[model samples]
Target: MKYEFIKSHEYLFPIEKMCKVLKVGCSSYFKWKSRPISKQLLLKEKIKQEIISIYFASKQRYGSPRITFELNVLGYKISRITVAKYMKEFGLRSKLSKKFKVTTNSKHSYLVVENVLDRNFEAKEPSKVWVSDITYIHTKEGFLYLTTIIDLYDRKIIGWSLNNGMSTKETSIAAWKMAVRNRKFDKGLIFHSDRGVQYANRKFAKMVESYGVIRSMSRKGNCWDNAVAESFFKSLKTELIYGNKLIKKEKMELVYVFKRKWTFS
Candidate 1:
């Protein structure tokens, strides 16, 4: 209870000092500390381990609130504050959100397609409606550009390509190849995307003609016109990109690793 003892073993001695200050004995304090760790402690450790595993496994996308909720679902009794402390100790952190600017250059004279989608995301058949979009990923090397085409009906990512240069060939070829691999050519099937140069280029237009598919583009400077593709990108950033906790050299490096991984769960 003396200041000398308080400074000797600061953390461990504090509890005993507190008990003594409250008129409790060292024998009772020892008894309490000596008692077997509760099942709750064991459970908390388990939850902590699982949380660390999930947090790192997800490349650091999860933070305390999400990790706490996950532990609760796994039958662990713990608070968010506890998870936050454990995360802090382990150097676990959530991903930093960066600003995303729209890179669509619709100022050119290229003809844009009509909005055939009309915000109808549903598809009766697999290849009936395909939505595509492009986004930029940051890296220490440089900006890495990405294009993805999705099957609206099955919610499957059918086609994707990554490149340093954002070109029409980069996107169209990726989408065309994916669509070709999946189903027979269906004339009048809609291929929707924003009115980026890649989608509106004459070469891309010709490629769409070669496939007998109709090209539909979002209106200029309109976010809602290509809502499906926009929403897909948003979810991708939210769940996979922005939510990650890892501080890698570049976003593309992590993205490349993630793309190759298959999450069965």
Candidate 2:
């Protein structure tokens, strides 16, 4: 284990010095290197290479546990701890979003409705209750705002828009337009979102009211009221956005997953 760590950091530190600090003899280490490789050692090396391939293929989003699960599915009988140890030896770690950026700003004079959904995440039928939210994706150039409308019935993203601005027209209005166009506006369908100005502004309210649908807003400073949208945002950032490669804005274009219907600008 000590030798492996030393080998991993060899370029950063001196080998003889590392051997002395680790209480390992330089001659002994070289002897082990010159020894013939056994089948067991060969298998271990192959598995280690596979671990590296899986880690990078996931864009460094997967941790030791998830990688171990994948390896087991691929017929490798390895433990999670062993995988974790190998990853640590190679200084391999999952990428995580290190910074926090607030996207919800409820400091507007617009009216906000009551929490009609009321922590009820499930819906009985399609278009029963649709929740919308906004999240920021960090990129090399700047932050990108992603607005999504999800149907609680199937937990699918029915409509979405990605823009550089958080204006009502770019964020909420665009997503809502796509949603109403794709899904039928049913009676008693509750539209839920946070108390952001984009959702509560007069323009958005008028558009939603015209459809004869119910309006719902999460309570001020209470995220649990819109738990579904908040949780979805968290998962999306962690699994797809955060810790991934920094995307350049000019070259950015996302293909919508639903039937290749629309492209997100």
Instruction: Write candidate 2's Cα lDDT for 1-265 as tens digits.
Output: 8877887798999989999999999998878667888999899999999999999998887788889989999999999999999999899998877877888899889898998888889888889899999988777888778899999888888888888888999999999988988788667789999999999899999989988889999889998898888877775665666665745564135333222432222
Instruction: Candidate 1: give its CA RMSD in angstroms.
Output: 6.8
Best by TM-score: 2
Give model 1's TM-score versus the native structure: 0.61
Deviation in angstroms for 186 in model 1?
1.3
Q: After superposition, how far is residue 38 of candidate 2 from its true place, in Å?
A: 23
Could you tell me which 10 consecutive residues in candidate 2 have the lowest summed lDDT?
Answer: 256-265
Q: Give per-residue CA lDDT, model 1, range 230-262, as digits (tens).
A: 766665665565744453456466656656641
The residue pairs found clashing in candidate 1 are 60-244, 60-245, 61-243, 61-244, 61-245, 168-198
- Write out the backbone clash pairs for model 2: none
